[model samples]
Target chain A: MMSRKVRKYFSFTAFVLPAFLFYFSLSLLPTMQGLFYSFTNWHFMNPKYGFVGLQNFINIFTKDRYFVMALKNTFKLVAALVILQPLIALLLALMIEACAKWLQKIFRTVIFVPYMISTIVGTFMWSFVFRQVFTQIGSSIPLLGFLNQSWLSNVDLAFWSIIIVSLWHGTPLLMVIFLAGLAGVPVQLKEAAVIDGAKPSQVFWHIKLPLIFYSLTICMFLTIKDAFKSYEIVYALTGGGPGWATQVMTLNIFEEAFSGNYMFGYASAKAVVFLLIVLVFTVAQLLLMKRREVEL
Target chain B: MTRRITPLYVLNILLLTLLALIFLFPILIGFLNSFKSFQEIFLSTLSLPKSWSLDNYITVFQRIKLLRSTGNTAIVSALAIAGIVLFGAMAGYKLSRTRTKYSTVIFLLFISSMLVPFHAIMIPLYQMASKLQLKGHLPGLSVLYIGLGVSLSIFMFHGFTKSISREMEEAASIDGSSEFGTFFRIILPLLRPAMGTIIVQMFIWTWNDYLLPVLMLLDMRQFTIVLSVNTLFGEYGNQWNLILPALIMAVIPVIIIYIFFQRYIMQGVLEGAIKG
Candidate 1:
């Protein structure tokens, strides 16, 4: 007969083994291998490769202007999204909350519809608007004539075009999150503050904002991370084009490995750097935000 | 509170109504234009279509292999969700129940790697998939999803299991039920809410995902709706008549599912955000 401890161990093994095997093979192992490969001169065609310690990293920093441009563009997108998405979402959520009950549900559902669509589809849909619909409107209305700019082609305009598409695709979720956060803010607290002769804005500032600081942090973190890793929209809307105008970090890494030079090791190094940036920003934000979360 | 319609309230409603219209505008245009001939769309996009025609959708449906790609998507989603829900539940429940140091370490190992972005692991994963003969295959892609997805699933399950009582499992064990038997017969049914959340989340993710499938599946027959639609767009860049209908078709299934499960989807998003 088996000892009781042996049986317990066996059960644990049986339960955990399936998940661990897949996770290790697909996720953990690849991550470790990616790190290792970043230090080598690996190529798909060549069977053999040699360690070229730090060359990939050095090349990305010193030699590759497109990589540098992509990095800057990613940060720019993150900055724009981190500020704009939450602000718009929070405002819309507050408005929706204040609406009639039936209207609130209808508005929330309608607003979130775009988010349910695939990113590629949504981006394509917006591209049509930017290309055709806006031009039609621009020609018909004298007052809105400026609406006809080449949204996806001209470099400066393309950045904003990508941002607009990303915002449209991304904001609905944050709005829903903010709406959920708003629901958690007790009505009694707002009523109590109002009974004390506080203005609506004052009550919102003093009571509601603190109560939903946790949600704000979450929304901001999501926006930042998502914007930094922006791909499908940029890929569909502009193809990171009119010459790399909207290329973000993920697109850069993808092109490096797959599309352009097929430099797998070099792309892995960029991916590692990308991962570190994401980790640092996300961890720092979480730590800073967690401390500010109100107990109530 | 008095039911007074102040200027502030009027402005708020108007502003919100305008914003809501803007939010709906793109999809509205896409839907409207999908029924228009290319000439009609080019002539006047803002107006209602001159005549609502089924020609665009008919052509797109015939050309894009919508039914086949949708089936492929369904297959991938089903296999991935099944593996994720089953294995994630097993690991999560055991990790939560067992108090051993090893359990703690194993649980942490899964949890900590949740922060690694997919791009960081994409290159090596592609290499691994190729080496393992998983490249260019749908079932192989599903297995990769299980690996990439299990961490978050396990985390969710682990947290959920903590909220439920353990007495039932213990009693079943006392009555000479094997551990697997206890899990399957007793505990799995009890995890309905969590299973629902994970299944919906995984389905939406795997269905909408563009990058992974693009990397893994090289064959046209293996394309998901997103991949097929992307290919259609590339082939017919300026052909909005064809592309818009395909776009609408690509999103139709998800939108239908969303409408039916609106409440659950909203709750899942909020819960996932807060928990993660």
Candidate 2:
């Protein structure tokens, strides 16, 4: 028994120690340091620092317009994606599924191609399109003169531009999830619903919708998560632009840390707050959606 | 019923097609714009240029030391993938099979980390790296990559390895093989598919990553492809000719690698989506 215990203990450590050390030192250390620095007024340049309790959080709440705007924009984006985007994606998915088998893959590929591009690439593509091509198209067409707007440069338009581009890049992911969910839905149920003399709306509202409730919930979680971590596209497009109008939390944290004199501790506080917001949003979404998930 | 579905479907398809065209438009413009002279790219950024030229590619290649930067990126990414897969698999095997208090704790730590955004700790991390003198070099970059990548890599491996039988391990051990040899000869071979997927994923992420490279690589010489792309944004003239080509050239290798590993790479991502 002693020998058996020794053998297992040795083998486990041999397997786990190498990875545990690296992961702890690099990933866990940074996380812990973030927690520590959140309590201190630590700047990158100044090596020596004293602990400053809750001042950063207070400043952000009281004085920091940037953090306030970021919080507002993040919530706004989350609401839009969770509420509006999914409806559009679901419609697209249902339509495509009902459309035809022959063209099923064609639409899927067309929609999903955007998801493959990096955020930087996606934002860059839209910048070129909105600023150049959209302008050109708008200017060329006489009847559609009012439709053409400068999307990226204007503060009012930039937020929507980010949202639209996000939908363009991200809707396919929803479509894919919905497609997977749609495929999982048994065909026999629809036939049963039809035989029961139900109207199309009744059949859909009662049958197809309830079946893919899990998918909707998962998609909502993903959409919210992506919304909070919305970094690269916003950063690339306007640099939280037009005087901090579009600055989300990630942008605020980045600008706080790297762009100016490094308020490392202050940045840590902002990041923690951002993390808490994301956590609350995610947990709330999960709880809300989990109630709707129909058990098989 | 299907016939009645046609109109809505047709409208949807048409809308999607138009969207796809718009989606594809920027890259097309980027491609065409690359060939146009800087004067042409700026003057008629929207229209087709009368004369196509190789000046942009030529300029970027000459000015940016394109080959050297590519070599640096390739080497760093390759080493990163190698370390991530090997270490992730070993660690995953242990945690999945063994029932220990530490295993649960370690696994939870790794999994919970997937939610934390990198920016949260990036400054402290940079400070740590600076303190350790692991700054602006290949070894330093690869070490950082391993740290960032291992959690997800291990998670993937854990899921894949969990589906396998422990009987194989016992059989190999009874044949007088060392535990390391058992893993190397048997389990590693069986895990080829998942590991292949992880390799391609780790490679692409490490290669295309812009932020870490910029933050770490202080020297102009160590600039990766994305870093070099920013070099095109100069104070004067802003060299769209040079920049466009640099962007195109940067993506070319990525395109090639993806094409080669496209199937596995896609499955890898799909698999990772569930895990992530």
lDDT of 2 by residue, A1-296 (tens): 55987998898889878777778877889988888899889888897989889888899899998789898988887788777678878977877787567677666666665665555655665666676657766777888675378786788898888887788767877877788778777878887888889886887788888998988887887888888888877876777887888888888888889987599989999988887788788889889888878976
Candidate 2 on B1-276: residue-level lDDT in tens? 244655766787777677667656666777777788867765667778677767667877988788988888878888888888988999988888877787888888887777766777787788878877778987788888888889988888888888899999999889999889999999989888788778866776787776788788888788776666655543222455665676678767866665565556656655555456
Q: Which candidate ranks first by TM-score, i.e. highest?
A: 1
Which residue pairs in model 2 clash with each other? none
DockQ of each: 0.83, 0.48
User: Lowest summed lDDT over 10 consecutive residues: which window, candidate 1 chain B?
Assistant: B1-10
Best by DockQ: 1
Candidate 1 is scored at a TM of: 0.98
Alpha-carbon runs more than 4 Å astray in model 2: A99-102, A191-204, B1-5, B234-239
lDDT (10s digit) by residue, model 1, range B1-276: 333677877787888888888988998889998888878888888878877878889889988889999999999999999999999999999999999888999999999888888888999999999989898889999999999999999999999999989898879989999889989998999988888888878988899999999999999999999999999989998889899999888988998899899999888877777787
Model 1 Cα lDDT, one tens digit per residue, A1-296: 99999988898999999999999999999999999999999887778899999999999899999999999999988888888999989989999988777778988999898888889888989999999998889889989999878888899889999889988989999999999899898978888898899998998899989999989999988987788778899899988899988888899999889995788888899999999999999889889998989988
Error of 2 at B7 (Å): 4.0
